[model samples]
Target: MNGVHAENLGARKAKATRWGTAFLVATAISVLFLVILVLSIVSQSFGYVLVISEVDTASLARNGVALESQEAPALIETLKEGLTRRHLATLEEAKPLESRNREELLSLVMMEIVQERPARTWTLVQSVFQRKAIFDFRDSDFPDGRLYFRSWLRASLLANPQSSSALDSGLRGAAIGSLATILLTLLIAFPLGVAAAIWLEEYAADNAVNRFIQLNIYNLSGVPSIIYGMLGLAVFVRYLEPLTSGVLFGAAEKGAASGRTILSASLTLALLVLPVIIINSQEALRAIPQSLRKAGLALGATKWQTIWHHVLPASADRILTGTVLAISRALGETAPLVVVGASTFLTIDPVSPFSRFTTLPIQIYQWTSRPQGEFKNLAAAAILVLLVLLLTLNATAIILRNRFSARRRTNT
Candidate 1:
């Protein structure tokens, strides 16, 4: 009997070892996949172009000398093939760089070429990308130009807004708007959701009424974000016109009415994410043993006091974690924002609360929908930005949760 028992125990230990090894292997593979995905996106974003500039030939010639190149690169052969000496001189003499006022410069270049050579004259336009070449001069008669490679990548994050492309799309406006929206959502949703959870878990009975409320919360969580967009359109955009539009900028006009304003977007997102906070908070509150609450109450504490002193402190880590997760969700959401009428194009940085705005996801969408291959690469880069932001937020939450857990254990 002892020999048989020993054999069985050995078999069990081997099985446990096998399962542990499999688990570790699976986890490693998953991490590796995520790493590769991120690297791919980073490479694309860094490689893509974002802005194009039109150099004013007359102005540039007046300011600086345009040295002639005997041989242009093979890629620019098409441009060089049809160019007359005068056009080439004009191209060389044009301003080598102009960062802002791209549209005006492009128009000026096109008009100058048209006036000088009534016949088709190819004009050289410069492009900026991030990390790579500073200027890419395209040989074209049309005013159209695109920023490619490294300069574009950097510009996408630094640029304010542009007429033509996502390369002109900068993170400055989107990033700030996103940060403000997230902060507002957290301020509005976290406390309210958590308070409701506390009330439901600590005070409310598990009666039909509470069950009904719980059911509704779950349902609301599942409701399509478009519905919430519609809600914002009705209440915030229409009825609360003063709050949404008039209060900030005298009502939704040409640049308004899309409900694309940051405040509207933020409030709409808050509604979308509120249920998540509430649900997670309730679960966390429930996890704290009832005995702990009873112990505090038994010691002559009121219900609110028991919760404030004992229950809440114990569940603090989980509550914080839930809030962070909700924020992460809000960060990536594009559909609701689109439904709310986020502009795919905007040059001015959103200043007043009611001004139109765009986000990273919308930017990516604009890029991908474009016919150019380079734009697709820009989209990939935008995705990488979002992923990094989400990962950073989540990592911070994990660290905070760990710290809280450690402190709670020490106190106990």
Candidate 2:
């Protein structure tokens, strides 16, 4: 009997070891894939490009009057004098350069007068390995083209607005729009989600109606986000146009032609994230010991007071964890934003909740859709920015959560 038991134990130990090895292998594979994805995006964001200029800076400065040397007013006058009426009108229509500052005017002069275009682009690997080939190609195909190694992710890319020319395009408007929409989404979703979760977990009776509501909330969390977009379109955009468009507040601007504004998109994302928040909050609340609730009640505390002073503080860290997950999901959401009418190209930053907007994901999607290789590089850089934004948000939330958790521990 002892020999037979020993053989069985050996078999079980071997099986457990095999399973543990498999799990480690799976985890390693996931990490490897993530590293590859990040490397690929980084590679596309920095490299060598052959830039061809239609007008040389030397030619523009032949009269010893460089555009950069002039003040804003003089630069504006030079732009008007040097450019044809049609070209000047086009520049103004794109964005009014006259009202802009000296630095902006200088950039515009370079963009319009110099007319620099990327003649050829090389990825990081190609730029490193085929340096001679890149120079030879530029020399043969574009003798006048200058080859320069440029990092696409720069301050100008983050500061300027979107442009038809990728060289002049930036993510400032999109970044602002994204931040505004996410802010609105969090404000709308967090309190409501937490309140609903608290009620469902601590207050609501275990009746058929309550059970059905719980079931539906769980089901809704798994629903396609685009469906929420459609619902948002019908309810927020069409039905509540006056409210969402700020028409009710008498703040609707002339440019806001419809209800497809930042408010509408934010409400859509709020709805999209609500279910997840509620479900996660409920789980967090449920994890608390039942004895804590009984102790508060036994001490003659009101149910609301007990919950407010005890239960919520105990679960605040987990609640924030849920919020972080919900926000991360909302930040990367593109389908619903697209369906709800996020603009693909907007040069102006969102001035209010009622203004038209675009997000980082939408901007990346639009850039990737374009045929130009330069746009693809721009898209990669935008992806890097989006990742950084997400990390920053998550880091801030984590810090708050940890602080709350430490306080709770100290108080106990």
Candidate 3:
């Protein structure tokens, strides 16, 4: 009997070792892929561009003098010389070109008068390794164009709005739309999901109706997001146009009757992530030991009181963890928002939930689908922004969850 037990113990140890090795190998592979993905994205977010102007700066420079070295008055005169009367009027409409400082005037001269555009581009890797070759190519093929390094990802990109020109475009509107959508999605979904879970887990009887509801929620959680988008189209956009479009509140845009608004998109995403939230919240509630509830009741506390005071606090961290997952999905979702009428090129920031909106993911998709190489680089930069936003949101939730767990432990 002792010999047989020793052999069995050895076999179990071997199995455990295999499983441990497999787990480590899987984790390493996941981390490796994630690093590679991030590196690949960063690679495309910056590079060198041959920015040639329609009116070459070389000519504007006069006898090999750099245009940039010229005084503000000279630059202003250059602009007056180069720009049309209509162009001068348009520039004056924004700000008096005569009153503008040197730097501003210089930029205006290059971008507006000179009409500097990306003549050719090179990736960061190529820009670094083939620096001489790239310079030679630019000198030979596009001698008039200036070769300069440009980082697509810029702080200005966050502040500026989308534009027809890729150089002038930014993710400000999309980022705002995304922030508003996620905030609304969390507001609408979290309470409803937690309430539903609380009722199902704590109050509902063990019967077919409840079981069916639970099973359906699990199934719904796995449904394609696009289906939810279609559902939103039919239900929110079409049937309940007044509310989603904010007409019910006496606020509506010109085409809001179609119900394609930020509120509608948020509602659609809320619906998309609702089941996941419900199921995960239910799981969290289920994991709470019955003894806590029984002890609270045994101390003469009401059922609602017991749950509000004890059960919820016990499961708060896990509920929040699940919420992180749900919101992550919501933040990254594009299809549903597209179906619900997200504008691809919204230049202005969303004024309200009723206004037209677009998210980073939609912006990325639109830019990526374009034929322009610069837009592709912009798309890559947007992807990085989206990833950072998602990570920041997730980290905030995790920090909150950790604090809850710590407080609960300290209280105990």
lDDT of each: 0.67, 0.91, 0.88
Q: 77-179 in candidate 2: lDDT tens per residue?
A: 7688789999888778867876788888887877877888888788898999999999999888999888999899999899999987778899999999999
Q: Give the per-residue lDDT digits (tens) of candidate 3, residues 1-412.
A: 9999999999999999999999999999999999988887898888998887787677888556699898888888888998889979977875688888786678777777677778777778888899999999988998877889999999868976787667777899999999999999999999999999999999999999989998899999999999999999999899999998888989997655678888999899999989999988999989999999999999999999999999999999999999988899899998898888899987668879888888999999999998888888899899999989889878978898899999989999
Which 10 successive residues of model 1 have the least lDDT summed?
115-124
lDDT of 1 by residue, 1-412 (tens): 9999999999999999999999999999999998887666665554423333343333333224331211223213323443577765554553322322444333333333322211111111222222223332333333354433353355436444433433334566666666777777788888889988988888899899999999999999999878988887777766766676645555554566545577788888889889999999999998999999889889999989989988899999999999899889888888888877777766556665677777777777887797766566557756767788999999989998999999999998
Q: Please identify which of the two predictions, 1 or 2, would achieve the higher TM-score against the true structure.
A: 2
TM-score list, all predictions: 0.70, 0.95, 0.86
Give the runs in model 2 whose Cα sits over 4 Å from its true position: 67-70, 84-98
For model 2, which pairs clash? none
Candidate 3: residue 251 Cα off by (Å): 1.1
List the pairs of residues colliding in candidate 3. Answer: none
Sort by TM-score, best first: what order?
2, 3, 1
Clashes of 2: 0
Worst 10 contiguous positions by lDDT, candidate 2: 59-68
Candidate 2: residue 67 Cα off by (Å): 4.3
Predicted model with the maximum lDDT: 2
